[model samples]
Target chain A: MSRPIYDRVALIGLGLIASSMAHAMKKWGLAGSVAGHARTAETRAAALEIGFCDEVFETAAEAVKGADLVVLAVPVGAMRAVAEEIGPHLKPGATVTDVGSVKQAVVAAVAPHVPEGVHFVPGHPLAGTEHSGPHSGFATLFQNRWCLLVPANADPEAVARLRALWEGMGSYVDEMDAAHHDLVLAVTSHTPHLIAYTMVGVADHLSRVTESEVIKYSAAGFRDFTRIAASDPTMWRDVFLTNKEATLDILGRFTEELFVLQRAIRMGDGQHLHDYFTRTRAIRRGIIEAGQDTAAPDFGRTKSAGD
Target chain B: MSRPIYDRVALIGLGLIASSMAHAMKKWGLAGSVAGHARTAETRAAALEIGFCDEVFETAAEAVKGADLVVLAVPVGAMRAVAEEIGPHLKPGATVTDVGSVKQAVVAAVAPHVPEGVHFVPGHPLAGTEHSGPHSGFATLFQNRWCLLVPANADPEAVARLRALWEGMGSYVDEMDAAHHDLVLAVTSHTPHLIAYTMVGVADHLSRVTESEVIKYSAAGFRDFTRIAASDPTMWRDVFLTNKEATLDILGRFTEELFVLQRAIRMGDGQHLHDYFTRTRAIRRGIIEAGQDTAAPDFGRTKSAGD
Candidate 1:
């Protein structure tokens, strides 16, 4: 195990991201001690029972009191309130970072409350699963994944230290401006999630196709959408609300493209549909080659006995 | 090994489905002998080299001449030509079936060409990977998957024999009418694929987000869309073209639901967004509880060392 990066690392929310961070830090010995706080007493109790944190506090302020590294792991919508509660309690020279999906809104929400000597480096780790909460986290959740940092005018020493911590947790860290990070995530995460939620909702609302039929035959393409659609509802709801402009921007472009394909289907334009599909196929190849995803077919999914 | 379900089985269009079927049949001894045909000589040679079939014919007519069962595994658009070519050469008591995605269109295309004493059962196995071609097939590809048969006006004995063959190859067989099958697939498969392709296209065309950035950041939900979008372009093209009406219907419903959620985001209606997202989560739980998918996180996908 490596030397600890910080004497005390405090996580402000004990959900999947926070729990996973605690586990990864413990696995790598990257922190001297981990402290956690959850809004719900049940979650705090579970985190203690799970034994990922050395200490559990009922208040965010108590959690941040002696920590040199403070991580805001709450939903985007809850970031501001937690920041306000923990601002005065953060150690003078501590480094603060977040695990929010959108960078710009997070920066806007939490940056103002950071103390004069403290550093705030907004970040988003490009990793997750449909499952959520403390039980859903694993030590390898961030393994081989990208963690983008928006270190807008933060001190160089603080930025480097935060980067080292993420690297220790098995992430490849990159620095990007907050606006660009938000826009990129809008295209890559927020918008795709919105589309998936919409498609699954459409299936749910269709009266002619019973729910059982949809679930039974979901292996045919729809199941992939359902996986993403099943992601943490509150987190995703905050994502759309916080990154409104960029999400809407990508959504508009998506609808424009969908309409074109829809018209092609209606007009029986086989050539147009074939060309479009062939172009998209190349993108998947690029992703696999980039080592962002496995090259295995069907994401290397295995069937349960009754599937 | 199980008893042979057919004396000789003919598979036209030796792509993923046909190749997998051949492998499954061979694994279970479901067919005494397998005869295969493909439009290209390279594929026929590959089938022979792969040794899944007893013989590979240059034409469908030659392949089905003495076969007791024939499977049309070509793209939906090519079903008519394949049926027309092999119609006269089919044995008097043969049962002709297909693995096309859309049933109503296949029935319309192949029914007229079927001889009087022969049975035409249109079947679709709800199984596949993003990969295609003869090299992609595996013997266990159909294990625990669903195969729907639209046995319109076919003799009961013929349908039963076909069901037995699919069961031998490790599938649970169900029968549905042609129209309902087409509509159900439209909701569960075709339209979802179209949406995924369109969303990936939107990402590809975005000038602000470089393709490299999109690929690098794909693990944050976009990679799932890319998997389905990367499916065989020729097959999906034919699926949309043939299942036009039902796909269009579902696309309309999808857009309407998307617009509602889009409006909520624009209006900053968090409750609406949260409710919609919460409702869709139930559908995913149903899918997992039905044993259609694994409860493991991320479809139980194991990342490669570099991923």
Candidate 2:
């Protein structure tokens, strides 16, 4: 472990990102010590048992006391309340960052509460899983992943230090305005997620197509949608509620395009369908060439393709 | 190798499914010899280079002349023409099956062209990749994947033989009526694919969300949709056109459900969104438990999840 960058780190949430951050920080010695707080006693106990936290506090206020870096890793909906509770306790000149998916909401919720001389940087790590909870964490979760930091008007030293911490933990950092981050995330994440959840929900509700049939035949294409739809509900619910405008704007665009293709299907317009489908293929090639996803067919359709 | 199940197998249209079938049949000795015919000379040359076909024919009629089993592996739109071209040339008592994603359309298109004594069984293999063409086939593409056979009054023994051949190629076989097969596939594959194509298209159209950002942040959710969207455009276009009624039916359902979700999001109905999102998760759990997909998180987020 290298010398500590932050004398003390306080993480105020015990979910996937927070738990991961704690472990990553400990592994790299980025913080002298890590303290954490969660709403429930069980999560607090589990965080300590998982050995990611050096101390577990009963409240967010207690957790942030004297900490050099305070990370609000709670859901977006919970950020404002947590910020209010911890604002008075934050150390002067301390850097506060968040791991929320949407940036604008978190910034709006947390920035007003930041004390003078404190740095409030809203950040999002585009890495996670369907699973959640304190137990679902690993140090390598952010390795090679993109971590967007929106440190709106924060001191350069604080932003640089935060970037260093993420880089030290294995992430490539990019800075963007919170609004742009929300728009990009809406297209790349929120809208796609809503579509997946809708498809899976439709499958569940269709009486003619039995659940067993949907599950059994999932490997065809529905399985990928299901994999995405299975992500943590609370986390996603907050994401949609917080990023409402951009997500709705994207949904509108998607609906317009979907109607055109839906009309093509209704009218047997093969050329329109072919043209749209072919155009989309170029983007997939870009993603693969950018090394964002596996080029393996069926995403490495190995022995585990089925049981 | 096992004794040849078919004395000679003719594959019409050497794409991923057809080419894979040829190589798999030869590898497992399920056919004494494999002959293939595609619409283009380039594909025929590629098939010969790939060595999946024992002989490449210039015409479907020439390929099926002496074959005991003829596989109509072209797009759903082309099945009827291929069947008509080879109808009189098909050997007496031969078995004809197809590898189309939709079945009712294929059965309607090809069954009428079958000679009285030649058996025709419609089939849909629930296995493939985004890549197509002769060069894209792999012998193990069908291994451990499901191949749903839509048997419509075909001879019992002929259906059994087709099932055995598919089993020999390492696919689990199931039989269903053609219309039901079409409906099930519309829900499981066609509609999801259409939605994915639309979502990717929407992302591409959004000027505010730059293409670079979409590709850069795709791992969050959009990457999975892109993978599905990358599938062969012509094949999918034909599928949507051929399975129009059933796909249109699913699209209606998806649109209805999506509206309810869109309304909930607009109203900030977190409870409704959470309930819907949570319910979808159960289906994902069922899919995993049923062995149709892996329980891996973020679809087993590879090393490039962030990069």
Question: Which numbered prediction scores highest in DockQ against the true structure?
Answer: 1
Can you tell me which runs of candidate 1 are displaced by over 4 Å? Answer: A303-307, B303-307
- Model 1: per-residue lDDT, tens digit, A1-307? 6679998999998888999999999988999999999988899988999999999998999999989999999999999999998999989999999999988889889998998999998888998899999888888889889999999899999999999999998999999998899899999999999989998999998899999999989989999999999999999999999999999999999999999999999999999999999999999999999888887777877643543
lDDT of each: 0.92, 0.90
- lDDT (10s digit) by residue, model 1, range B110-177: 99999999999899999999999988898878887899999977999999999999988888899999
The residue-level lDDT of candidate 1 at B260 comes to: 92
Cα lDDT tens digits, model 2, A73-123, are 988999999999999989999999999999999999999999899998888
Q: Give candidate 2 regions above 4 Å deviation.
A: A304-307, B304-307
Give the candidate number with the greatest TM-score: 1
Instruction: TM-score each candidate.
Output: 0.99, 0.96
Candidate 2 yields a Cα-based lDDT of 0.90
